[model samples]
Target: MNSSWNPTHGWEDLVSAALVGTDRRPLPSGAATPEAELFDHAALLTVRARAGQTPREGRPLEAAPQERQPEVSRAAGDRLARILGGERPRLLTEWLQAAAARGHRLSPHLLPELLDQAARDRSIRPHLGVLAGARGRWLAGLNPAWGFLLEEVTAPGAAHETWELGTSGDRKAHLGAVRAADPARARHLLEETWEKETPQDRAAFLEILADGLSLDDEPFLENALDDRRREVRHEAADLLTRLPGSRLALRMAERAAACLHTENGELHIAPPLACDAAMERDGVRAKPPRGTGERSWWLQQIVARAPLEIWPRLFGRPPGELVRMKIPDWGREVMAGWVRATVLQGDPEWARVLFAWDPLADLLAVLPRKDREDVAAGFVRRHGLDGQLIMVLGGAAAPWGPDLALAVLEKILQVSGTQPWNLSELSRLAGERIDPALYGMAERLSPEPPIQEVAALLRFRDDMLKELQ
Candidate 1:
């Protein structure tokens, strides 16, 4: 090639020669053919183009903030690395909770991966904040993808700043923080911006209000029943219904009393004939979804939103007595409404009676943890491992105590012979929730692969928990 076939000039000539025929634009000297010469020069110019750029200075990065909380034990850190590396990753949440409870910080090198994992699985976000420490906060400050870590762990003062100026998610997080500290203050903050916020935001803020709900919040929520947005009105009514003394609750009680009453040891029913303006204003829908009769829908809503206390008073009997007694005509609708009310009111006595009437997972959630385990154990002993069983187990909190754990193990062994396929979800829950001390017992339960898998996870979790301790 010619001496002028340098990095800059050489690229220009190669492009011109290749585009227009070499006959019109003569090839630079070197190779025998124009094609050969063009290829050789192009290769040379590509390398020169890539390697010839002048380097520029980069801004200095600040060091990560100092962590006040001490790091987790070396063994615990190694286990965390393994969990993040994808060995029984579901245990990551357990590990995070354990570490946080121990008042330890996460190893700095592991923050990025854990943060990434948390971004995908939001259930872990709550545990991640305290354990992540100052360094994790620093990393979150640098990377917008992990910004949720900052929001989850923001200080009370910083929360107010975020509420004043941050994005929608940030504002919500701020409001949650304020609500936890002072429900009244949070309500006032929302009230100040009530008119300025969008309908969606109004609904979201109302949901936050549910955490520290009181009779004090009844007035604000009652007014919200007239919101232009359906969702905002719905949320307001839900909050009101939970407060049995609220005016909306009293109205619902009166409406429900009109529809449902008992006479001569048999329950009578009178479903609403029409959806009037008064009923609609109290947050009842004018229309029903497919397959549900409009009158039945109205009756269900009225019963569900009415105070649970109304039942015992009307029947002159305890919840246990009422739950066992069948509704003669509207059995499905009335029982379903009572279940909804039981959940909303969070009455343990009602939940216990309801669970006995029908072993439901939603009702299971309302029971205390010990009671939950006892109820689940009783159900497992009677019922076979099935979809509903899985849901029931899910409602109870983990490290499911010895009675429930052994009951589940016995069921696993029993089912292994006849219906092994059903063991998939049951075995997984057993491994995740069973107390780790039972690893040996679990291992010796059966030779089935599913049984063995549960044993292995139990052992792994045993070691994991010890390392944290």
Candidate 2:
């Protein structure tokens, strides 16, 4: 009898009744969705309701159905070696076609081999439009690894294409990797397509290519500052601004130095100043500084152009003493920009001094290190006991480089008082710049609860040491 009727009993009651009847045949759960499968089992009914007709004895078996998409198996990728086994042209062309047909998201597991092998084949390469031209650039557009092929398939294929292809693959990865692996070679690759790409693409490509953005990349980036595209100009400007060590920064530093000076025991600068013809010749320009808030404009251009090194000397006689000096209302903001420049240059000593001036000074220190020691000490001194850093450094972590910074730190946190500010502010000052010495002093003077908890962490020394007795 075909039944098509609603029952007064709920699914659980029906299952219990069926269980009592001894109808033990298992339901066809493999074809059902998980929710439907749950309704078919008497065992679940017993477990959920805490009542069973017979005593519950065994754990229920998990029943997750296998997902099926037969055509796009991993083997579909591995079979490329044999599917067009003998046809060279067919082998090459078909591979590209297959990938194009697969839409943009290549099966994640097979993508590496697919990209390496497909890019090497010259004939398959010429037809690569199957992604850009045929697949309609949509697939490649979404995937940075493939989107890079835009210039490659259009240009000639050479072994050097590996560098071009490999580096361009940076779209998938971040600039940090490309910058780490040979900054010069990557910069040159961008230069080749500098004029050809759309202004939008050009700006973006340069932004990624901006890895290891050193003093050398300055001239070219400066040239971009004048590009017709505002975005291109802004990106170039943004990078130069970030580079506190650049020649542009040096020039701005000199200009800003001229403005700070003597007045009745006060540092003095009126509301505004123009980037005279000389400043403009040197790439510091202010257009009609009258109405556009000239003081801010002059300050922005100068701070952006100035090298961080000028701050201490420009504002006062001694660099160390400047730590105590304060510029009235606007001077601190103006000086803060100078500090950011110092941090961008990745100079520890300068960052240390600015760091001394204000605890919040740490934000400006977004630096990189050629040798880990530079940043490592700062990290340990600041965040040595921080849970995240401890996890990142691993178990055998011993301090390396500038161990003295920790001593400096121990003295600082030792200062008495309940964290003169906010808890969020404490998290910010952690990492390399944290001082183990200050941590020690803080512990010694007034033990914080978290500090005690951190001290209580389980440690493992060789049990063999105990066995020696």
lDDT of each: 0.83, 0.47
Worst 10 residues of 2 by lDDT: 458-467
Ten residues in a row with the worst lDDT in model 1? 48-57
Best by TM-score: 1
lDDT of 2 by residue, 252-358 (tens): 66677776664554566543455575565444456635655556656655664566566555555555555555566467546655565564455656555654565
- C-alpha lDDT (0 to 100) for residue 108 of candidate 1: 77
**Candidate 2 — which residues are off by over 4 angstroms?**
1-183, 207-216, 238-247, 263-265, 274-294, 311-316, 361-364, 367-469
The TM-score of candidate 1 is 0.74
Query: Deviation in angstroms for 3 in model 1?
Result: 22
Residue 19 Cα positional deviation in candidate 2, in Å, after optimal superposition: 39
